[model samples]
Target chain A: MTERFDFEGNAWVLGDNIALDGELMELKYALARETDPEILRHQIFRGLDPTLAERIRPGDIVVTGRRFAHGNPHIQGLIGLRGAGVGLVCESIHSGSFRCAINAGLPFLPRCPGVTALVKPGDRLRVDFATGALQNVTRGERHQFDPLPAELRRIVSNGGWLPTFRQRLAQQN
Target chain B: MGQTLAQKILSRIVGRSVEIGEIIMPEAELVTVHDWYAANAARALDEVGVTELFDPARVMFTTDHEPVAVSPHAAERQQRVREIAARLGIGHFFDVGRGGQGHVFPVELGYIRPGMYIAGYDTHVTNFGAVGALGIAVLTEVSELMALGSVWQQVPQTVRINLHGQLPAGISIRDVAQKIIGELDPDLIDDAVVEFAGPGLRHIGIDGRFTLVNTPTELGARSAIVEPDEIVRAYLADRVDGPVELPRSDPDAPFRAVIEWDMALMEPQVAAPPRPDRVVGVSQVSGTRIDHAYIGSCASGMIEDMRETARFLKGRVIHPRVRLFVTPATNRVAAQMAEESLTGIIQASGAVLTPPGCGVCAGGRIGPVAPGEVSIGTGTRNDPGRLGAHDAQLYIASPATVAAAAITGEICDPRGLDPDLQPREAAHD
Candidate 1:
């Protein structure tokens, strides 16, 4: 299947040190044993910002700074974002968070300088992920980086590694 | 081109010589998860419509975090995890008491072997590095590990840390770990594989090396390893269930950097409140009063640490103002403490010996730090507001240092307390 690397979304801006266990996702839920993806999809970022619970739309983009999702290494929050069709483009990310975003099939740009400066909480961004081109229509700024390789593009296209891995297992069998 | 230990292991796993910066696929000999992620991992498997795992026997599930299942929610979570493990036909499931901390339990139970590749869900999975396994904390990506049975990898640039000399009286690996945190905080450590070597490494044992492994994960290390030697061979000769293989870095291996330290120069150290990396010599922070003295957590809750705490507090009672909490890391260790009478001596010194679990060190699930309270803890991290109360202050130190602080109701140097507890042999780092 050919993957769609281009996306148009409304950007949501957050700051650095958004903890993986608590702020991005509730540790209590991981502790409380809440695993149903639907319940989790709505609860994402509720603790970070109450409006995030309701304001998030399908295919929205997230903009944040270094150490984004820094603490505790829980990825249920990323799962929620993937379920909601979100894209993450940040100044930098905790390596753990970077892997989770890719694994969860939430297309991400791991490092983008001046991301927060160029986009606000609700700005339209026409992103050509194939070329790493990001256009912030509101501020009239253009940003880009090196795009992912073909192998990674295939993994992301399959909605992260798990599905692709399952297909390989089936194919081999 | 000489290969670092990490490169050697990855090369073996990938069936080819691997280079730094290359992305490769390497399947772990095993993938592990604790109670927090087990049930969720099961649900995710069902969500993806996959019933068969890549290999069921290789997946391990254990319970360590909040083992008591104190709340109804916690109990329910544990129950769900067990049910899912059964449904998945997982061969290695350690429920409640059977498994302590997944990281150390694997080492103690002989599940981890030298040069083996292991992926785990929790951060402290780095603990397996004590036994010379390439145990990486897959964290959020464990879901994929569960489904794919493979871990994605970037062949990390490795830095060798050469430890030299003796750990002088009153010094321990906790101080060494804190020092690594402070010094290895730069880009040199982030995403880099760390290997500990040098003559002083022979002084440390498996349990002591656990302290060093615990510190590197806090710094974003892929793995913190000490190549297994005679000390490890002797430790594993009778303990491991299967044959073991030892992999080492070549004598002239290419390295990102090599760090050398003399242990004799280290004094009793304390990590100042609010962050584990903000370290200072114990004397600099001595006399600062504390309300709580906690001696447990995956980082320092091993028998070695508890024995040191017991030996130091044998004849003396802690200050009346101090509420000292001593929780064992594992039930086996708790039983061993009983057999050795370490529990009796420690509790007699006014410290409460609770059941084995990760408590305040995890977040006040058991003995919480009250708001406005100042505490000295031996947990892995002391991030602000982590231990229940955001307003409370927590200083990180070794168990022996904590025992000293408990006696004085204030931060004090363990070196000055008593010459009675002479330092013993250490483990590999």
Candidate 2:
């Protein structure tokens, strides 16, 4: 199935480019060490806020900074965010992390710096990615963006080129 | 005025062309401010008449350079980022623990994408090129443009890095990056995009690509890119729709510089303090003692990194004098390491594994060394205050080298370890 990502239903509208405005919330270390002998051995991993993890649903849009997927480029982080049903619209991103997200099939909206200023976390938003216009369902705000080139929008809205191609194939079939 | 890629991308998000390096007007798309060089962007935005124009939805903030907030005043300065983000209606804020260094988290959340342009206060923002986007670090002029919804830019000349052979086992993506940076004069590719090509890239995972792409700034390049492949398709399948095809440079495309590297004969390279370009092989630093070791960050914080550490530390204890910390890049990587049983091997080796933030790479996030301390790890930017105090010295190395040093408390070749040693059983999910 070619999963498609559109800004449907209620979405928060941010008018400016406030893509990066969230709590740091680094995963908790499993253990505390003042001074440890082993340099390469230990059992600590990044932990996340269960609440935050659960708060996000699929298709939710995350507005963020340039290098959003900075550290590790862990597929887990991408999967967790994607599984929560959130899409991303940020200003910039790290290359490796971008690949991880794309490979994971996450819906990403790049160069949408105004998203942060246009929407709130819970504000209902509807995005016509084809037209690059996002409507804030909650605050009755309407924001227009330079719509993606029709082809690019198809690729993006259809969840990337593969899905878009599959959808095209289906139409032909 | 004709539009550049930056202007084109920005216009789609914002409604107009914003004056670059000028006072704000209101069409800015997304704005990012870091502790380092943030004042420049802030001042630029202010000068452009944008006291608070960022659309909270389009702003992302991170504290990297001096990981520790430094002075209470510095903490206050950092706090201002949140205040500004909130005041400007910014929705995403990565206060310390929430997001590790700026280069690591935003992309993990799926915010940054391909074919976009980004401006940050720091030089390293160019790391965004790995996913085929143009990441540029600019002064406040661009910040204000972000606030006003636009910035000016010229289409960058491009450079191509063609790989001809596979990397030898026990080698890492970091080595490739360091080797390239070391061999290529920093000035040759200045203000240009460096794209990765050839079959050699296939052996490298995304983490490896991050390592290579992260250091374009040091090379004086504008950005870095790796052509999208099936690996990208498979990775993106679960997130959005399905297989997607992204653009890659043409094989015969004009390039400002072209370099070919054979991965098979490549040796692990290290970037010594004070310059990433000062590269050397493991044989050169043999027996060089280290005080601290870290294995984390977007550059080296993946499952492959953990496995490499385990392979080096298998059935061995860390040197008594060294303090080694291993932080996975994210929760999933840590879980995967556990499942792969690499975590146990690492634990049995006596290293202290940390949580998934940007641990110790930028110094302030986890634990920074005191003055005169020396540490080796797979983190980025060994600048002053990069770890804790500005005087602390950091040596950037591969995960293998970092792990080997952690285990031996001295610089040691990771290849000395038994490569045939099998990893532990996979852990139950």
Candidate 3:
């Protein structure tokens, strides 16, 4: 399978300290241990923007400020975003959320400092998650940030930790 | 190029020197899962087509949560957990009533030691830091470790917190920990391992250090540890059979930041609802009425905390309006309380004694606060719906403050209570 490193989409700008449990996704869904992306996608961002889930298109990018997905590193939010075919570029993220993003197979740029100032909501943005090159197609601006480390990118590219674990098991067999 | 405690520990695990921000897959020395998550881990293992663990001997399972089968459904879950443990060939299986809290008993039983890299399914596994072991909370990722024998981890920088002076009367380490987390900038501690140092280490015992290490993850810290010294050595001497190695950082170790705090100036602290970091001095929220009071969890259910609560409630009775529940973190702690006669004093003071386990702090599974009620206790978190009802309010503090609240039926400073006051009847307002 080929790993696509580039992503293009419209930006969905969010502020700092967007919590995982109460804000990005509700606590009930996570507590229910619901992993079905179709069900989760409808509930994503319902706390912050009720209509945003319906408006999100495939390949849409979420641009967030520092401390994205700050509280309780539940991966339902990341799974929902990935299910919707959206990518994320945050100014910064907690270590637990960073691990969840990789494990959920969500394409993310976790350390794009000052990224919120680079693009406006609804702007067309193109990102190379492998090379850390972010292009603001709407404004024709270019920016650079550190890419995911090779060790972690491999897990995301393999469609999360489970698939990677399966592959490792197969190799062992 | 001196290495912090975190760097040194990770380097030893991987058999090579590691740098901060570098990802490494080092085999864990010990891994633990409690009853609450054991089923989830079993299901994940089945989904991954794993029939056996990479090394079953290294894995442990304990029935710390729901220890007494609160309901028929809980009974069924416990039965299934036993079956799963048997099926998986887990080496160390502490069934209900055997191990108290998975975090606390491991140290008591000497399963945890200095310079060890361990993993657990629960966040408060940071309690192992009391003995100088780096216990990282892997959440549901424990399944990956069980199957593959290792999981990826990025080395984190270390933050040095230096404490000085001695704590004034009635100020427990929990208060000091709450204040430290409230004041430390989240950015500096985020994704960093906090290393507790300075002269204050001599003043705090193992149980107090557990409270200090257990609270930092709420602020996004990767993990926390204390530099193992004679205190740790003395505590582990009788518990461990083999030679124990105590790890410390180099004098010039590179720390992201250093924070110095004087315990003499510290005051009793209360973490208000909505978040654990919303800490304020006790004077700020005194006299607020409460419906319930709890004093247990991995955070404060140790023997020392029990002694402190007993000391305050010796001859006093709790307010009639408040339902105070005292839970020991482990059965051993309960036994100690009974042997020392603290249990009778606590129960005689009108405080109900629950079974030794996670108690109400485990999502209020055992003792829950009803709607429109307020509670004060030593639980780790006070998030909405944390203790029972979504509308219920929980204020967290040290055991002494909680005892004071139980007596007055409201939040009050423990220091303000008269030590010589006589036992009185339940207050009727």
The total number of steric clashes, by the backbone 3 Å criterion, in model 1 comes to: 7
lDDT per residue for candidate 2 within B1-81, as digits (tens), equals 343333334344445654322222223334556665555556545544555553557766765544456479778877776
Docking class of 1: incorrect
Candidate 3 residue lDDT tens string, B271-347: 99978999999999998999999999999999999998998888788999999989898888999999999999999
Error of 3 at B265 (Å): 3.6
Model 2 TM: 0.61
List residue ranges in candidate 2 displaced over 4 A.
A1-173, B1-30, B35-55, B63-79, B99-101, B241-243, B331-348, B363-365, B383-385, B388-393, B418-429
Clashing pairs in 1: B203-B426, B204-B426, B204-B427, B204-B428, B205-B426, B205-B427, B205-B428
What range of 10 consecutive residues in model 2 chain B has the weakest lDDT sum? B420-429
Please tell me which predicted candidate would have the highest DockQ against the true structure: 3
Estimate how well candidate 2 is docked, as a DockQ score: 0.01
DockQ of each: 0.20, 0.01, 0.75
- Among the numbered candidates, top lDDT falls to 3
Worst 10-residue stretch by lDDT in candidate 1 chain A? A28-37
lDDT of each: 0.80, 0.61, 0.89
TM-score of candidate 3 on Cα atoms, chains taken together: 0.97
